[model samples]
Target: MAGIYIHIPFCKQACLYCNFHFSTNKKLIPQLVNAIAKEAFLRQDYLTETIETIYFGGGTPSILPTSDIVFLIDEIKKIFEVNSNTEITLEANPDDIDEANLVAWKKAGINRFSLGIQSFIDAELQWMNRSHNAKQAKHCIDLIKKYFTNYSIDLIFGSQLLSNEDWLVNIKTALSFNPPHLSCYALTIEEKTVLGNKVSKKVISNIDNEKQAQQFNILMKELAIAGFHHYEISNYAQPNFESKHNSSYWQSKHYLGLGPSAHSFNGSTRSWNIANNALYIQSIENNNLQIETEELTTTQQLNEYIMIALRTSGGINLNIIEERFGVTILLELKNKITAWLQANHIEQKNNFIQLTNLGKLYADGIAADLFF
Candidate 1:
């Protein structure tokens, strides 16, 4: 199955730690929406298979008017074979989750939501310069549960201002809603972001790796008790509630991405639209796509497979690797991972190799080491 990702590069305000490509200018909303719809028509043949998922990712898709969202969906349906049960998700912030918008979103064919509830702590929310307060974060869940059964909330851990006790309270507060899915991410200070600038100027302390690791352990243990499956390293889901769009990404399924800074991937080639919204609109108007294309080399593909699969619960399938690559490559991969196996960092079952609890801490490092 295939999927579509539409990047709405507009936001009300920039978060302190965000490094994503987005503008705070709401004036470009109309032009951007029309451009995205045009892009869908232009790239119709990117995926041959029926579309199973459509994700409206951000800069806060909920910030748009409901009518615009409906129009985009209708435009896509006109050109693509969208599955009747296709999972359509929109990313939202707590402040935008009013009854009016929620009802409108449901009516516009948005079956799921990914709420950006970074933390339920007022102080932490302030530190992150989030648009919503702690009260809004907690209150929005009740409103959301009333409408969408398949929704996910995002939480961040490892901020210097967040204590272990505070982190526990945040987790408990989110669990109180019993959300179908949770995506917990570590707070990373990316360059060019406000937090990154503060750290460089010594305005704030650097992140504590030890503290982050401790919080991750707490998240895993608590979520497991609450019956959430840790399907991916950063994602947890209740039974049958996994993110179909993201799962398709991990499985290397073909997907078409529209709008500024969005990416697309078929099996052999990958492409991304220009990050500048003005440039994107201009190019679309000129009937030209401002995108860069790359045909992945065999080694590049194998390395990518290793990186993605290793971070997942499925780990790396040796037989699939052997079948797709070669037996020689599989043997070489096994030999490369012998050290990690001996170190008790990874365990192998009949045909799958998965990271152990201890190994998960160094997942990126291990995955890099195993890359072809």
Candidate 2:
């Protein structure tokens, strides 16, 4: 099944660790929403299969008027073949969620939510420069629990202000709500962000790799005990609540992304839109798509597959690799993973090779080592 990702390139405030393409100016929001709708129609023929999921992501989709969100969904439905059970997800921040907004979002056909509640500690929220305070975060969760069942909330571990006890408290707080899905991410300072600048200037302490690793381990252990499945390296879900849209990406399914700085992928080629909001809107209005495309080489595709698949709980499918590449390539892979297998970093079960907890610590490094 295909998927659609609509990037809302505007936020009410910028978080310290965020580097996503967004404008704080609310004046252009109306134009931006219209531009996004236009882009959806422009790229309607991009996907061949029926759309099973539509994700409204970044800078803060919940900040938009409910009417604008419904307008975009209606536009997409008119132009594309959307499935009856399509998973429509809107990424929301705690501050934007109120009873009225939740009711409006539900009316707008938002069946799922991805809440950005980075931390439960007020100090941690301040450190991250997140818009919402701790109290508002909890209050929103309470409101959401009353209205929605299919939702996921995000938590950032390994922040300078968070201790292990604080991390446990944060996870426990989320567990107290019995959320269906959780996306726990280790904070990594990306370039061009305020956090990155702080690191460069020694204005703030750098991320301690050991501390991050410890927190990751803590997250995995806590979630597993709480009966959450570690479906992906960064995502955990209870039972069948795993995000279909994100899982499609990990499985390399075709998806069309609409909006500035959004990326689209089919079977062989990938493309991305221009990051500038004004330029993106201008180009769409002018009926000239501002995007770049690239064709993936066999090696590039294989490496990409290895990178994504290895991060998942299903691991790498040897038979699929053998069929797509060759038995010779598969044998080489088996040989390459021998050291890791011996070290118990990875384990082979039937045709699937999955990572062990020890291996997960070095998942990226191991995937790179096995890359073509």
- Return the TM-score for each candidate structure: 0.99, 0.99
Where does the lowest 10-residue lDDT sum fall in candidate 1?
Answer: 354-363
In the order shown, the candidates' Cα RMSDs to the true structure are 0.8, 0.8
Supply candidate 1's per-residue lDDT for 31: 93
Candidate 2 on 1-372: residue-level lDDT in tens?
999999998898889999899989878889989999989888877888999999999889999999999899999999999998999999999999999999988888899999999999999999898999999999999999998999998999988878999999999999999999999988989989999999999999899888889999999999999999999999999999999999999989999999999999989999999998899889999999999999999889889989899999999999989999998889999999999999999999999999998889889999999998
Estimate every model's Cα lDDT from 0 to 1: 0.93, 0.93
Q: Which stretches of candidate 1 lie over 4 Å from their true place?
A: none
Clashing pairs in 2: none
